[model samples]
Target: MSARTLLVDVHTHLYLPRYASLLRSRASVPMIRSRADGDRLIILDNEPSGGRPVGSQYWDRDQKLAFMDKHGIDISIVSTANPWLDFLSVSEATSMANSLNQDLEEYCSSGPSFSPTLQRLYGMGLLPLVPSISVPTILDEVDHVAQLPHLRGVIMGTRGIGKGLDDDALEPVWSKISDKGLVIFLHPHYGVSSSDVWGEKDNGHVLPLALGFPFETTVATTRMILAGVFDRHPSLKILLAHSGGALPILSSRLASCITHDPVVASRLQHDARWYLGKLYYDAVAYGAEELGFVSSTIGRAGKYGTPTTEAVAGSSHMTFGTDHPFFPPILDAVKQDSKWMSVVENLKAIDGVRDWSEAEKSAVRGQNALKLFGLN
Candidate 1:
């Protein structure tokens, strides 16, 4: 009989007790506290009235295994949840980042108490980027994680150093990470600037979740493209969270804008569409049509101006993810029995794609991530 297919979850998260305790001790946006009415897990701006309830799933290995089993995930490359060291002082951020990375490495190596079949768990390390930490310190941490056997790569927020990912000072950090053969899992922590999107009122985190998160990722990556980061580091692989935000849909338009503007056009060797091919997208789009568009658009190769159908079929760039712990079931729903709506929607999108082979589906489910991060 054929070997059981490998299903990998490259984007899952684990708070891990050591790190969760650190968040609990603090009283800030990234911190966790119990509410009077019920426990909640809050990790965002303006969470002044205290955040969500920190539970076992956030820190418990057993729960992670159970969740993986229910979802048929063969391996999970876990990482620290968002707002990673972004709010601390420069010195404190560096220290906390080092500690968190060590903690994650230790947990994965020690082997959590779960079925032996669930033993393929792994992780992506964290980095500090607050109050302008030095590049050397960042490089040191990257090298440290690279040496760890189970540590695959680093999970980072859009903001690099302080200015953003486009800042020239961050080039060395990116270079070192790429050289180490580590995939940069580019995730978004700070959503869109509050002033630009949502006003004072709380829409139950809808603003950040629905709009800010993906848009922030799109803008950060766009800035990198315009700055020629991809051209400079052609082999540097980045796995974009949330299907590259709006990049896939807006790439052609972004290219058109660059062409029209002589000032921006003069700074780049190639157009915006050229860099789209260099990047990788996750299959987190909520609909099959959107997933199909992302796959067809980014997976296309050949000349720059070639039509999507005419372009050569390229390797699959999408992977599966469940933005868990954050999008848990509402109070009205049964938390344990009901699969997450967000995860279910993503699965359906992948299932609905036409013309994609079983091998391509397996790759999107896990193989591509395995090859990308060298997790095999």
Candidate 2:
């Protein structure tokens, strides 16, 4: 609500043309099928007919700037959207990761001639994490990413090295990533297996995309907690997608389950709830109630009022996001200049939380991401 508050959208995406070209050539689940209307992205096997309509918005920088301008967004921290390089040959993945990252760096630093709206962009890079690659190769990429002038961090999927994030193989990778002081933007791609319930039902992609993605994120992060990735690399920072899925809602129950267990409880330095606070969340939960819950639970859930807790509380841990190009405009815009409904909903969520002051809201909008990524 503050006039001075800079709106920072952390949850927006742009697939580099190089990456899209790879997808176009591929013959797999995450491939893109050309169409008369526009290219359709089929991330899941079930969405065989075609996934969402893929157009210039997914890869074009001009469209990205246009969306930001229309939305009144002050700044954006862009990333490669879901289904990121997960299904490539090890050599192919590694090579492509480096090229895409360099391309992104060029895109982000594409000159400072423009004014605030079109020019306000930063990037999160990627890793070639398909399991067969050596940890050294992954670490090499981490070191490589650190050198990109405009890149803040790397985005990773839940299936770390294809063995899930909890795989012991990821430890060294985690350490190196943390060593660079880079954020690991933990976005979800693999939702719950559809075989259990969704396969039999014709619920469209709603069940898998809406529910399954978040749930997968919840499970993956929880597994990391149990594996003590946080305790090992306490400096490592992970920003979760979709407001941490159900992790914020069920954190205490998870802690209780972990604590009650005679084996797991005895091994941890802190409870399950403590680790949740260590993570950051994007404000893409879609409603004020959900945003308020996420802010209170994760921001103040564990060990509230400490010097450390105070640092992470309020809007400091939550960043705003538009998820543009994915959720296009639907319904008539209330105002001729109004942005997409998906973007407006997120803004409304932040504005609806009356308990937070202008300063708090401002932090969630941009200040947090700036400090977290050292963008300021």
Which candidate comes out best when scored by lDDT? Answer: 2
Q: Give lDDT for model 1.
A: 0.78
> Which residue pairs collide, candidate 1?
39-53, 40-52, 40-53, 41-52, 41-53, 42-52
What ranges in model 2 sit over 4 Å off?
1-4, 111-119, 304-311, 331-338
Q: Candidate 2's residue-wise lDDT over 264-372, tens digit each?
A: 9877777677787788999998899998888888765557323454345746689888787787765455755656877888888988997788788878887788778
Clashes (backbone N, CA, C under 3 Å), per candidate, total 6, 0
Q: State the TM-score for model 2.
A: 0.93
Worst 10 residues of 1 by lDDT: 306-315
Report the Cα lDDT for residue 54, model 2: 85
Name the lDDT of candidate 2. 0.83
lDDT of 2 at 288: 92
lDDT, candidate 2, at 6: 71
Q: What are the lDDT figures for the candidates, one per model? A: 0.78, 0.83
User: What TM-score, computed on C-alpha atoms, does each candidate reach?
Assistant: 0.90, 0.93
